[model samples]
Target chain A: SQKIEQNSEALNIQEGKTATLTCNYTNYSPAYLQWYRQDPGRGPVFLLLIRENEKEKRKERLKVTFDTTLKQSLFHITASQPADSATYLCALDVGFQKLVFGTGTRLLVSP
Target chain B: GAGVSQTPSNKVTEKGKYVELRCDPISGHTALYWYRQSLGQGPEFLIYFQGTGAADDSGLPNDRFFAVRPEGSVSTLKIQRTERGDSAMYLCASSLASADTQYFGPGTRLTVL
Candidate 1:
């Protein structure tokens, strides 16, 4: 079975610092990998997507990297703010548009 | 444009009862998906529909779960003989098309007591 793994533990960072989250998958040859931000009471919102052929992708202060060899993707948020505090999920997109999501890593940015 | 929307933000039901959850996809979206998220686990794919047809129903856990998209835009997931183990947040999402990014709804938190 395909599986995804995130940091699992919560990551605490000081405001304005760069916070990095990791997503690892096994037995998945994903054509694309995606990152999403989810608040406590709300559903996940699209963040960034990086393809297997693409090494990295960036949007605003967000950046994503996909390494097929390592079967891992890393998400970075620079200039982190308190408002950025939320749980981040990584999804591995196999064919047929199905996604296997990781447990997610809780990130808390404090001033 | 308005994103995906789901009704009954919260539902409390009794075991062995039946429950229905609805999802309205974004206009013109060709792909609609259903997922379940437990307390600490990530969202698990339940089903997928392309237009009015279920392109993939393999994610469905058991025969107790079923879904339909009669108009290709709105879908309903019906669960029969609900069990306490069925308690979870059911999330609906839609994308412009399959193989594209998906936009999710606030989700319906279903609890079976």
Candidate 2:
């Protein structure tokens, strides 16, 4: 089975700073990696997706990088705001058939 | 247009009871999925339905877990003999295709006492 791990359970950062979250996986090679944001009491919303062939992808202030060699993906939010304080999740596609998600890392952006 | 909707926003039941969670996908979506999210954890895949049949149900934890997508628009996740461990938010998502972007619903929070 594939195992996904987020770097931390929670992260605290100040507004205007860049919040970077890490996701690592083992025992599998995924063709696509995705990032999502989940607020309290709500389901996750898709943020970005990066394919194995692409080293990096950006959407507005959000950026994602996939390092297949290291079996890891990094999610970054530039100029973080209090609204960005939410649980961010990373998911990997299983043979492009299914998706497996990590536990997620909660980001707390303090104003 | 509605993204997705789930019935019974919350449910409370006793152990050994049977519970059903319902999901309504977008009007034109052909792929639907069911997942369970425990406290502080991400959503775990339970089943995937392509059209009217289940394409993959390998994520179902046990025999007690079953899902159906009759008529290809609505789905129901049925759990028999529910246990305390079954308490979690049951989520449903839908996409245009099996591997397309999935849009999730508010979810039904199930509490087993």
Candidate 3:
């Protein structure tokens, strides 16, 4: 069975620090990998996407690295603020626009 | 310029009942998708529509779950004889084209007791 995993534990960080989240998957060769930010009781918001051929992608303070060989992707948020705190999910395009998402990692930034 | 929108932000129903959740995709968006998210888990894809036809529905858990995009703009997810296990947040999303960045709606939280 295909599976995606993230750190189930919440990550706590101080304001202005960098927070990193990891997503690992098994049995998938995706063409595109995307990151999303989700808040409580709301839907996920798109962040950034990195292709299998692209090693890295960035948008402002957010950066994502995809290593198809490792079947893992790392998401980094620089100068993190309290507002940046949320559950981050990594999704893989499983063909035909369908996305398979990881469980997600929660990040809490304290000011 | 509006994003995806879902109706009845929250719903509560008894077991064996039927319910319908609605989704209005962004204007001009040709692709619409439905996903269900459980506690402590990410959104799981349920189905997607291209125009007025169902492009893929393999993610649907069972025959009790069905979705339709009659006109390709608005969609409805109908669950028959809902069970307690059906409780979860149902999310709707849309994009200008297939494989495009999907913009999501706030989601409808379904509580089956």
| CA lDDT scores, all candidates in order | 0.93, 0.91, 0.95
Superior by lDDT: candidate 1 or candidate 2 = 1
Tens digits of per-residue lDDT, candidate 1, B24-48, equal 9988998999999998888999999
Please state the CAPRI-style docking class of candidate 1.
high
Q: Is candidate 2 or candidate 3 better by TM-score?
A: 3
**2 versus 3: better DockQ goes to:** 3
Query: What is candidate 3's lDDT per residue for B17-87, written digit by digit as tens?
Result: 99999999999999999999999999999998999999999989999999999888999999999999999
Interface RMSD in angstroms for candidate 1: 0.7
Q: What share of the true interface contacts does each candidate keep?
A: 0.86, 0.76, 0.84
TM-score of 1: 0.98
Best by lDDT: 3
1 against 2, candidate with superior DockQ: 1
Per-residue CA lDDT of model 1 for A28-88, tens digit only, reads 8999999999998678898988999999999999999999999999999999999999999
Q: How far out, in Å, is residue A74 in model 2?
A: 0.8
Second chain only: TM-score per model? 0.97, 0.97, 0.97
Model 1, chain B only, scores a TM-score of 0.97
Regions of model 1 farther than 4 Å from truth: none
Estimate TM-scores for all models: 0.98, 0.96, 0.98
Model 3, span A1-111: residue lDDT tens: 899999999999999999999999999999999999999999999999899999999899999999999999999999999999899999998888999999999999999
